[model samples]
Structures are given as C-alpha cells and as structure tokens.
Target: MSGSLRKGLYVLSFGGIAALLVLVLWRRELYLPLSLLMIGLVMLPFFIRFERRRLRAEELLLVAMLGAIAAVSRVPFAALPSVQPVSFVVIMAALVFGAETGFLVGSIAAVASNLMLGQGPWTPWQMFSWGMIGFTAGLLRHTRFMASRWGRAAFGFGWGFLFGWIMNLWSLLGFYDRLSWPAFASVYAASFYFDLAHALSNVFFLTLFSGIWLNILGRVKQKYGLLENGRAG
Candidate 1:
C-alpha cells in the first residue's frame, strides 16, 4: 500500500478502537485505566522508533521545555486558572516532525504532568483528550487545512471547540451520579460559557502564534530532517 494510505488506515483503526473503548467500556474502572495504558502502548513503538531515527538535541530540548512548561502551568499551589498552550506546541511539532511526534508529545506530556499532580481516573481522560487533539492536528497537517494562516485558524478553532466539548462530556459522565441532576444540569448549562471562553481563547492564541511557530518549525525541519520511518534518528 502507499505510505499515506497505510498511515491513514492505521490512524482510523486506532481511533475506532479508542472510541469504542471510551463509549462502551469506560464505566468499568479496570477498563478505563487499561484502555489508557493500551493507548500509551499502542503509541510507544512509534515514539521509540521515531526517536531513534531522528534524534536531534535541539528538538529534544524543545520538546522537554514544552513539556516542562505544560507541567508547571498546572501547579496547584495557586488558585489561578491554568491555560494549556501545549496544544499549540503540539501542532507545531506535528507540522514539523509529523503525526507520530505530535501524538507522542501530547500523550507523554499530559500523562507525565498529571502524574506529577496526582494520578487519578481523570488522568486518563486528560491524556485521551490532549492526545487526540494532537493526533488530529497531526493528521490535518497532511491536508491543505494547515498549509496557510486562514487554514490554521479554522483548524485551531474547530479543534478547540472539540477539545472543550469532549472534556465537558467526560467530566459529566465521570461525575454524573455524584452530582445532583438538577444542580448538574444547571452547572452544565452554564458550562457553555466556559467552553466558549476556552474555544475563543484557543482560537485567538493559535491565530496569533501559529504563523511564527510554523516558521520556526520549518527551520527546525530543514536543519534536522525527521526520521523517514517515523523513528528518531
């Protein structure tokens, strides 16, 4: 099969399995954690292989820096609300190195950060949400949607809305019985405002930064080409 076609099919298959596990088996505690572990496992080979083939000190440093920033941004010492700029960084990585790198950054950064904060059931959801966003952004990189400023803006907005919606849905499902239905519904209704804010903020930040980020990534790619077989060199 052609490389692009093969990659496309692989991504679709993984996504299908992930969705089924989330929708059908997420209620079972074992299933949730196991599913998350499986996700990490499924992506691990790709990450390792990519790393071996395209190991660049500068890129590694950048990835580490981005992950550290994301982790520190969520420090619970203060009551300040944290904004995740990791998604923007993930998009840049994906555009530069490709889909596998993007997914690796998103999944590893999220899981590591959450573990540092506290390992809970919520960790899996956060991993899934962030990983999925980066994965999708990477897939979109192959399309014209990420090739220009307007395209990147639209892609960022759509993904932002999707990320907020999915996070809210997961929160509701995970906390359904614990929260009184009336109160939950009221809170849920009001949550639209929060979601809107998140989406708008993501759109604004991505629009403003994507151009410069992409240019930086282009330079990185030119200086150190990515692994041909998706492995780190």
Candidate 2:
C-alpha cells in the first residue's frame, strides 16, 4: 500500500475504535476516554502525515516531558491547589509543532492524566479547555502577532487569562445544579482573591516565559526545520 493509503487507514482505524469505545462506554460516563478518542481522531491526520514525518526527537522528548509534568503536578491535598498549568505546555507545543500537534498534546495529556487520577465529568471540560487553547495557539500562527517575541507574549498572556476565565465559567455552568446563581455569586465574590491570584499568576508566567519559549522554538525550528514552510511537513 502507498504511504498515504496506509496513513488514511490508520486514521480510519482510530476513528472506528473511538466510535466503538463511545458506544460501549456511553452508559458508564467514561468521558475521559471518549473525549480522548475524539481528540485523537481530530489529530490523526496531522500525526500520520505532517507530524509523523517532521517531528524531531527533541520535540517528542518535549511532549513526553510536558506530559510528565502535567501528570505529576496533580496534588491530592484539599487545601493546597494542584497547579496544572498544562495550557502553557500545550501552547509551547503548538508554537513549536503547529496546531495539530498542540491539540494532540493538550487533549491527550489531560485525558491520560485524568484516567490515572480518576475519571469524572470534569474530565471532558478539562479536555475541551486545554484542546481549545492549543488549537487557538496554532491558529495564531498565521497571524502577524506570532512572528515576534512581543506578539507571542501577548498571545500567551491573552490566552492564559482567557483560559482561566473560561475554565471557571465551565465549572460554574457544569455544576450549576450544585451551585445556583446566588451561591455561585457569593462564592465567586468571596473567592475573588483566589481567582485574582490565579489569573495574575497566569498572566505573569505567560508574559515572562513566552519570549524565552519563543526563542527556544525558533532554535528548534532552525535546527530541525520542522514546520518551517507552514506546510506541516
């Protein structure tokens, strides 16, 4: 079989497996695996064609490192929050590998980690949030803003703030039965300090690290010439 045909078959097989899993697991609410399968389906074409050929050893290593970081960062303490800044890593991957790779990393990492930790309805939300962030980062590639340090910095900060806000909103919306408007308002009002801290931390981290991250990505691109011509491979 031709390489393209093989690649296409691989993608189709992934999709078939995902569909079967979803049909079998729908009643049990195995959302994390279902969501992951969907993400893999979305990213399969890129992985098989573009990313498979162009990904460097360093890039794969980075993906593994980021995934490990995300998995290990989850804390069991109730008082002390688990700082899963998976978005940052996802953005970095997207910037380096392009959108498809970024999506794969973000979605796969979230779902895989959740599976290890324990799956819940929240898993799907997490997957959506991280996946969207990575996809947006990839989409930003075509814009002039991603061409320079300042532009990338701005993109990171903007996305970070947006991610924080959106995730919070998703939580509120998903748990609306347990948290009514008045209760949510009261809780949000009281937790303003925590929310501000989270948002500000994201802003600061993204702003401070975006430039450095961009430089590293530029070096990788220079050395390996991956995704250099914006043609995926």
Candidate 3:
C-alpha cells in the first residue's frame, strides 16, 4: 500500500471507530448497523489491497488453510475461557505473510471459529480485535524490535489484554445506560485473570514456537515464490 493510502486507512478506521462508539452510546438500537460499519471500516483497506494483489489459487488456498488451522485451534482450549492458541496462530501467520494476509487470516479465523463456538454480538468485536492484532504485527514484522523473540513475545502479551478489553466493550454495551467508571473498572477487574492467562499464553507460545513457525513459513514463501512482492499476491 502507498503511504498516502495507508494514512487514509488509519484515519478512516480510527475515526469510524470513534464515531461508532459515540453513535452507539447515543442510540443503542443502532448497534447492529454500527457494528457492521465498524467491520467494513476496519477491513475495507486490506481487502482493497488484497484484491489488487490478485493472489494465485495456491496462495489463496494457503491463506484458507492457515485460517482453518487458527479456527480449529480454539477447540482444544474451549474449557480455558480466554486462553487459546488462535491469537498466537494469527500473529505467526501475520509475521510470515504481510498485513493484508494477516488481517484476512485473523478475520477468517474469528468468523470460522465462532461458528463452532457459538456467535453473538461479540463475534464482530473479536474479528476486529484479532484482525487488528495480525495487521499490526505484520506491519511491525520488519522492525528491529519484532525481529527478536522477546519483542515478539511482548507483542503477543500486549494483545492478550487488548483482546479482552476489546471484547469487554461489547459486554459493556449491554447496559450502556448504567455505564460508569466503577462499572467499567469492575468489568475489567472481573476479566483480569482471564486476560492475564491469555497474555501469558501468548508469551509462552511465542517464546517456544515463533522461531520454528517463522522458519517453516519463510521456507514456504521461498519455495513457492509466494508474496514475492513482499505482500500477498
């Protein structure tokens, strides 16, 4: 993506999110439409770039496979509330592929997994959260910081809490009228342990598996000449 276009997307996504929150708070009945709008704003740029890239059949299949793997990863840890390998998978995929691919993988995983886990208003929020995690990770993939294992682990750890916080926003919307600082604090406090588990799990996965996954994915990219343009195509 061009620098100008990326900047535009950043503005649109952040501005749209802020507007959506205000609109939702002002008129709760508009939640569904606003939620859809949120997804569109967050996803539009990447999909547009993806379309332009025109990935080959095999490459597309690879994306689908990674997404499916991420979706299924949630099943084994169904009993663990917030602890799951989904985020780790998404992050790893993003680190190997580019941002557009990462976003697609994350969003696909969210929708696909929720089908088995049960969907609700929370689904879109999850899609947004995970998608952003992948997007941001991919964006920072080349950074000196992310080039290190500790940096990758830290990235994963941060997203663990961030993912929970994003999900909590959906729950908060349930009683918008009763929202207060205390209520907000309590809601986050309630999720503290679950979020911590998620963060720690991310660190654990990244510490032990990032190198292996990166090497595997890097080899695939090399062997297939996939993403030769440095982005999915």
lDDT (C-alpha, whole model) for all candidates: 0.63, 0.61, 0.87
Which segments of candidate 2 are over 4 A away from where they belong?
Answer: 1-62, 70-84, 115-118, 147-153, 168-174, 177-195, 227-233
Candidate 1 residue runs with Cα over 4 Å from true position: 1-62, 73-82, 115-118, 177-190, 226-233
User: Per-residue alpha-carbon lDDT of model 1 for 39-80, expressed as tens digits?
Assistant: 554565456545545465766776666566655645542242
| Clash number for candidate 1 | 13
- Per-model TM-score on C-alpha atoms: 0.70, 0.59, 0.94
Across residues 1-233, which tens digit of lDDT does each residue of candidate 2 receive? 35679567767867775685555344334444654565456555545655545555665666666556655544332244433455666777777667766766676677777777777666655666676677778878767877665676566556555555645653454344454668667656655554454445445556677678767877877887655544442
TM-score (C-alpha, index-matched) for candidate 2: 0.59
List the RMSD of every prediction in angstroms. 4.6, 6.5, 1.7
Best by TM-score: 3
- TM-score for candidate 1, residues paired by index: 0.70
Predict model 2's lDDT versus the native.
0.61
Worst 10 residues of 3 by lDDT: 224-233
Per-model clash counts, in order, read 13, 0, 1
* The candidate that achieves the highest lDDT relative to the unseen native structure: 3
Cα-lDDT of candidate 1: 0.63
